[model samples]
Target chain A: MSLLAVGTLAYDDVYTPYGEVKMIEAGSCTYIAMAATYFVQPVQVVSVIGGDYNDDFLADLQRRGSDLEGVEVIPEGKSFYWAGRYHDDMMGRDTLDTQLNVLADFDPKVPESYRKAPYVMLGNLTPAVQSRVLDQLTERPKLVALDTMNFWMDHALEDLMAVLKRIDVLIINDEEARQLSGELSLLKAAAKIVEMGPKILIIKKGEHGALLFEGENLFSAPALLLPKVVDPTGAGDTFAGGLIGYLAATDDLSFANLKRAVIYGSAMASFVVEDFGTRRMQTLDQEQIDRRVQRFGELMTVSL
Target chain B: MSLLAVGTLAYDDVYTPYGEVKMIEAGSCTYIAMAATYFVQPVQVVSVIGGDYNDDFLADLQRRGSDLEGVEVIPEGKSFYWAGRYHDDMMGRDTLDTQLNVLADFDPKVPESYRKAPYVMLGNLTPAVQSRVLDQLTERPKLVALDTMNFWMDHALEDLMAVLKRIDVLIINDEEARQLSGELSLLKAAAKIVEMGPKILIIKKGEHGALLFEGENLFSAPALLLPKVVDPTGAGDTFAGGLIGYLAATDDLSFANLKRAVIYGSAMASFVVEDFGTRRMQTLDQEQIDRRVQRFGELMTVSL
Candidate 1:
């Protein structure tokens, strides 16, 4: 089974207490495709970038089985650029720069070959753009998951709520969940958000863990408790990518399978935070991924 | 086998969004003994109270198999009085009043029959008082679990460390774990904390959940997702009580048993938050408690 991802692909400069990096390759689809490759193959990506990007990065994605035919590159324009600094705890960050040169006019074009992929992941982007991708799909994928930020909730509620009604799953951080639902209690927030649209709501609680709420059932996914988190820029997108990819591979949407999917997603995210800007995710082999996932299961088991 | 709990006994005036209760029977030992009685028999308690306390409250404790021979009553003084207001989130509270009354000169006295009890749960109290109870023990108990607060970390670090060395387990909230270890990452904090004394650490994250760490093994317990949390005052102490009480009843301290203990603790803690000042706990029956605990098990399980 194949997975389809649609979002921005760009160059990012990130600062953290541990250190700083300049002009590194990053973006929503970038980390998503990288992490998803560990689970399902032929990750077809639909995103827009500019001529300023490096060729080696494209080669890396393609080499990892990413179908980049839908990745548009405009030679005359600069790529989307973002600069941010992570706080000491790695839970919060301040956006220092965002030059949306090509992304400002980003018009995603889902390739004809990619439109019928079995799984779809809508990475953090404009809700209208997310909606546009759904409009382009020739048939509904087996699973449709959407990830959004506080930006859409603040500026584009109409578009966001409209898109939310069409997706099967919504992946967001704890703070975003609170802001979007206006509920202080997460349990109440999950109930409210599910009422608004998606059948499943996954609230990502950074290092604490993740919670999956579907109907009356819930599953708590454990995050690998690391001694340190170097950079957490793409952890959430990586998690979403890992999740949808696992679902596509297993071809099951049962709550039991989705629980395992969350564990897989958590393992992928744990790798992302260990290094800077997709570096650790890029080098992860299947054995290393399986080992981390096994640990999650061990961390949760109790023989009674 | 018996469970011995040593802590404060007082009257609490609580203000929550749900409502307010004036001079309700409450205390660290009150909730602990109530929760412990659900799992084990002969819950021996050591604490001080005032003559002004209600006789019906004492009758209720004895009705639940609480051996109160060690409880000291001061005829001329008022009971320890506390007033607090829960914040909107229900995760934090502000102390509006604290009249130590008889607790000012509180002296814990462990009874002879309680000295050899197989399980000990020291609810939040002064480090010196916690240590004194340990010193009074005739022989080392099978398991000694100590729960404390940030107040002791700030004022009684030396004594806390001394008691920590003698205990088998330490239970504290996530914030206190960070403060005690001076490590922001919980994984690193657990590594440091285990080195200081106790071999096991349980970091309670109010509504988020709880994490158990013992050497390389770990377990995550999910907090019950309530539609509304009326009060959170004695949830932690109740958790400690449930945990030790289960251990005592089962007479097992293996890793597998400890994992079950935490789940029982989480189940007990969840009940405490549903109402004000031990109201819910006082009314709980065994069947209701077991059903909640079974639900927790189902929530955490992920079939591979």
Candidate 2:
């Protein structure tokens, strides 16, 4: 089954205690495409890039089995740019600048071939944009997973809620889950979220791990606890890609399958944070991915 | 194999958004004894109470197979008392009052029966007191686990180090691990701690779960992830009780056994915070514990 991901393709400048990397290729859609390409072939990416986007970066994605036919290039505008610096612990960071040059008027148009993709991932973006993608779909995909942030919930909750009702699963951080559900406890927040829409609710706890709740089935996937965390930027999006990618490749969305997918996502995310932007992810291969997933299985499993 | 626990037995006045539980039965040793009693019978508790300690509370301990003959009742002093209020989220709290009273000069005397117990748990307390218990041991216990707080590390570094050298395992929270190791990364902190003395180090990330590191094995256990957390007080001590108690009951100190014990501890601690101090744990039975452990096994297990 093919997968279609809609988000941004932008430039990011990231700073960590280890040092800084300038003009790093980044964005939610780009991250998803890169991570998913490891498990699934020809991930169709629908995003807008600007004239300034590095051709080499685009070529890299093509080499990794990411189809760029759906990515629109706005020749007159500048690429979206974001700059952030991680704190000492590297779990949290402060955004330095957000230049939404090309992204300011982003109107993602899914190509004809991409619309019928069996799996869809709507990365964090304006609710209107996410809804636009849903509107373009001829039929609901086998699975529609979404990633959203607190910003949209705070400012565009009604639109976000409308988009949420159309998705099969919603992936959000702990704080976003709490804010959306008006619940303090994550478990309560997940239950409330599942009632609102999606059959599955994933609460991402960053360094703590992620929780997947569907009805009464609850599964936890611990973040690969690394001794050094260089950057946390795009880790969440990478996780989403790995999750959906694994599920798409296996053509299984059962609770058990989703649990393993979360582990795979976690493994992919662990590589994303090892270096700035997507440098580490760019070099990761299937062997390394499987090894990390095995490590995650080992770190969390115990026989009675 | 009996388990000997040394710590405080006191009353706590806790207020939370859920409600207030006044004069709730608390204390590290008390919580530990109750949790440990689930897996190991006849847990030996050594600590000082006072004339004010309730008779019914003591009777309840005896009924639960807690050998309290080592409890010294001071006629002139009062039982230790602590008052605290949890914030809305229940993850952090502030101490309102701490009246050492009888615990001001507590000199725990290890009973002759407990002196040779195979398993010994030194609950969080003054490092000097912890050392005294270690000194009283007639023969080295098969396993010695120590729990200490930031207070002792801040005020009694030498004494804390003295005790660290004698313990087989050290149980501490994430913050304490970072503070003690001076490393922001938990993995690095655990590594640094293991070098200090303890062959095993368990970093408790309350509500998030616990991590166990011994030799090359690393095991992570998820917290119960309850829908509601009425109170978080005594959760850590309860977790320690569960961990050591399970190990003592099985008399297995292998790395695999320790991993299972950590899960049991995580399960037991989940009950500790379901309501105010010892309330949930008090009502928990072996069947409930078994069910929770089984769920934990399900939540964490992944076939490779």
Candidate 3:
């Protein structure tokens, strides 16, 4: 089974309480492909980048087993760039700047060979763009998981709903869930959102962890405890990547399997936040991940 | 294996999005005794109330197997009364009124039998009053657990710190933990607080869940999923009661035992939030609690 990861590849200027970084390699696709590569090989990535994007970063991702055949690079255009400052709590942030650049008129093209990838992860993007990626799929993948933010619900709800109906899973934070469903209670929000489209809804609660809902069955995943979060830059996208990647590698979509995937996702996320951008994700090995996963199990284990 | 509970027994008026209730039987001691009685018999309760306090409610608590010999009746005064409105999220609230009345000049007198109790729970109240209860105890209990709020931390740091040094366990919400330790990260806060006195720390995160930290060991407990939280007034005290009660019943203080106690606490807290004041807590039976505890286990169980 193969996983198709489609989203941005951009440059980010981030400021956190620990420190600040300039022109760091970032974006949803960057994180998704990196994390997914740990469980599945040749993460087929489809996105648009600009000439300003660093070649070394591309080489780094390629070495980690990402297929970049579908990435459209504009010769003269600048890459998408964003600057943000995290609040002291790290849960909230203020976006200082966002430059669309090459992404303004972007069109995503799915590589013909990647069209049939069984696990497709549509990272945070314009809902219309997410829907277009689904159109290019040769067949309906085993799981079409989309990650979106509150912006889509506010400005492009109709388009978002269209994409929601087509996907098998929706992964959004608690705030996004409330905005989309107009319900404050997460259980109520999950119920209404599942009815709207996807059968499975995951409400991510940053440090608090995530809730998975499939009809009457619900699973809660705890976030790995950390004394400090150096930076929270790509945690969510990394989580989505690790999740879909595990599902693709194991080729299992059972609810039980999804729970394991969430733990793997959370484990990957815990690493990403330990450092700015994806530094920690790049350096961690399978053994460290296995131990982290075990720690997660231990964190919630109790003999009663 | 006896447990002593000391705090205020009062009347509360609460408003939530669901509805509003006025002059209901509410207080830290009331919730604690009710939840603790399920696990430990003759929960020795020591608190001060007034002539205006409902006698039937006290009789109801007594019926639940609480030993109320230490409760003081101030016939000339009125019971402590609180009025508050919960925010839409049910996490934040605004205090509309607080009349300490009888609690203003309270001096707790631990009963002779209760003075020798091995397990003790100090609910939220003036640090001076809580210290008075400890002073009257015949000997140091096996485990002295204290619960306090930010108000005490802000107004009586000297007295609060003095009480902190005497307790084996410190159970407080995330915000109060941060406030007391002056650290934004909970892990850091737990580390700082534990050094201050308590050997074990439990940081409760209302709907998010609870965390237990003992030295280098840590445990995370997931909150039960509810469609709606009717009211969250006494959830914390209920959690403290359930936790201490379980410890007293089993007479175990191992980290593993503490973890199970946390799960029991979380289960009890979950029920408290289902209805306003103690309405839900008063009606729940042991069978329901057992099922809820099993649910807590299932909520965090992941077969990785």
Candidate 4:
């Protein structure tokens, strides 16, 4: 089965202690599509960008097995651009620039071929935009996983919850989980969110790892224990890519499968933080992916 | 085949949002011995107390299969006393009182029966006291695990490093590890500590979990993902008890065995946080232990 991801495909400027790199290729849809391409045969990406968005960048995504037919090009506007500097901890960041450009008034249109895709990933974006993509889907996808940030939770909470009820899984960072549920305890927050809609809740704790809670069963996947994290800009998106990619490839959404998916996501996220922006993910290959997955298995295993 | 734990046994007054309990039984040695007794047949405890130390308390430790022959009673002084208040997170606490009483000028004397024990747990205490206990051992234990706090690291860096060189395993919290090694990254800190002396290094991350680093192999054991934590006073000591206890019970110090030991320690720590002080460990039985172990296995497993 194929997977379709809906979000921004944009250019980013990232600053880290390692150094500063300008005009780095980034965005939720870009990383998610790249990561998912490893597990699935073909991944479809739907988003809008301006003429300034380079052809080479689009070609790279195509090279990674992503179908770019759904990616719309706006000749007048510029691609979404964001600039941020990560602190030493890599856990916190300060946004230096955000020019929505084409994303300001863009609309997402799921291509006809992608309409039949079995899985859908809603990356972090405006609630209105996310809802628009969902509205365009002819049939409900077998599984819908959504990733959102604090912005949507604060500004578009009602729309966010509306989308939450329609999705099968809701993935968010720990702080957002606490804010959405109005509960300080993550467990309590997850339980409350599950009651609101989604059957599964994945709480991402950044460097600490992620948790998969379905019913009474809870599984934790630790982030790759790196000595130093160069940049953490898109680690969360990379994790989401791994999560939905594994599920789409296996066509299995069982709790056990979801646990493995989280591990894959964590392994992919580890690479994302190894270098600034998408530098590491760009150079990552199947061999490196397998080795990191094995490392995650060994790191997490409990021998009897 | 057996383990000996040396430290204080005292009454603790603790307050938490869940509730408050005055004069609850608590002490690093007491919790450590109790946790160790779960896996090992009998844990020998060595320490001193005053006339005020209750017989019923001593009986409680003995009932858990701890040998109290090494406990010395001081005729005139009072027992050690501690009071603390847990914040909302439960991961940090404020020391409200610390009356050393008989512990002020204590000199631990390892009993003849305990001198030949194969495993020894040096719970948090003065570096000099830890060194004295090491000096008293007739034959070097197969494994010596030392647990220390930031207090000693700040006050007695030389003595602490001296004792660290003589131990087989060193366990300290994440902050202390950073301070001792002057490295912000845990991976770097662990590597630095291994160079200093111990072959095995454990960096505790409180609720997040703990990391065990030996040479190139690293194993992470997550803390029990509980919805609520009543108290966290003795959780670290209980964790140490479980680690050394599991090691002594298995009589294996290989990396594979260390993985299981960390899981056991994590499970024991989970129990400690469920209630105030050592209350939960006190009521825990073999069946509960088995079930928690099974849960941990399931939580970390991935069929890759």
- Report lDDT per candidate: 0.90, 0.91, 0.92, 0.88
Q: For candidate 1, please provide the TM-score of chain A on its own.
A: 0.98
Q: What shift in Å separates residue B286 of candidate 4 from its native position after superposition? A: 0.8
Which candidate, 2 or 4, has the higher lDDT?
A: 2
True contacts kept of 1: 0.69
* TM-score for chain A, candidates 1 onward in order: 0.98, 0.98, 0.99, 0.97
- State the lDDT of candidate 2 residue by residue for A1-304, as single tens digits: 8999999998999888899989988999989999999999889998998899999989999999999998889999999999998888776789999999989999888898888889999999998899999899887899999999999988999999899889999999998998999988887888889887899988899999999998989888887779888888899999999999999999998888999999999999999988888889878888998898899988987887
Question: Which digits, one per residue and each the tens of the lDDT, describe model 3 over residues B196-271?
Answer: 9999999999889999999999998888888888999999999999999999999989999999999998899999
- What are the models' TM-scores? 0.98, 0.98, 0.99, 0.96
Writing each residue's lDDT as its tens digit, candidate 4 over B110-190 gives 888888888999999998999999898899899999999889878998999899989999988989998999987788888
lDDT value, residue B188 of candidate 4: 86
The CAPRI class of candidate 2 is: medium
Worst 10 residues of 3 chain B by lDDT: B293-302
The local lDDT score (0 to 100) that residue A269 gets in candidate 3 is 96
Model 3 ranges with Cα > 4 A deviation = none
lDDT (Cα, 0-100) at A64 in candidate 4: 87
Q: Is candidate 2 or candidate 4 better by DockQ?
A: 2
Q: Write the per-residue lDDT of candidate 3 for residues A1-304, one digit (tens) a residue.
A: 8889999999999999999999999999999999999999889998888888899999999999999999999989999999999999887899999999988888999989998888999999999999999999888898999999988888999999999999999999998998899988888899899988899998899999999988778889999888889999999999999998999999988999999999999999999999998899889999999999999998888776
Identify the candidate with maximal lDDT: 3
True contacts kept of each: 0.69, 0.77, 0.74, 0.70
User: Least lDDT summed over 10 consecutive residues: which range in candidate 1 chain A?
Assistant: A295-304
After the best TM-score superposition of candidate 4, give how far the Cα of residue B87 lies from its true spot, in angstroms: 1.8
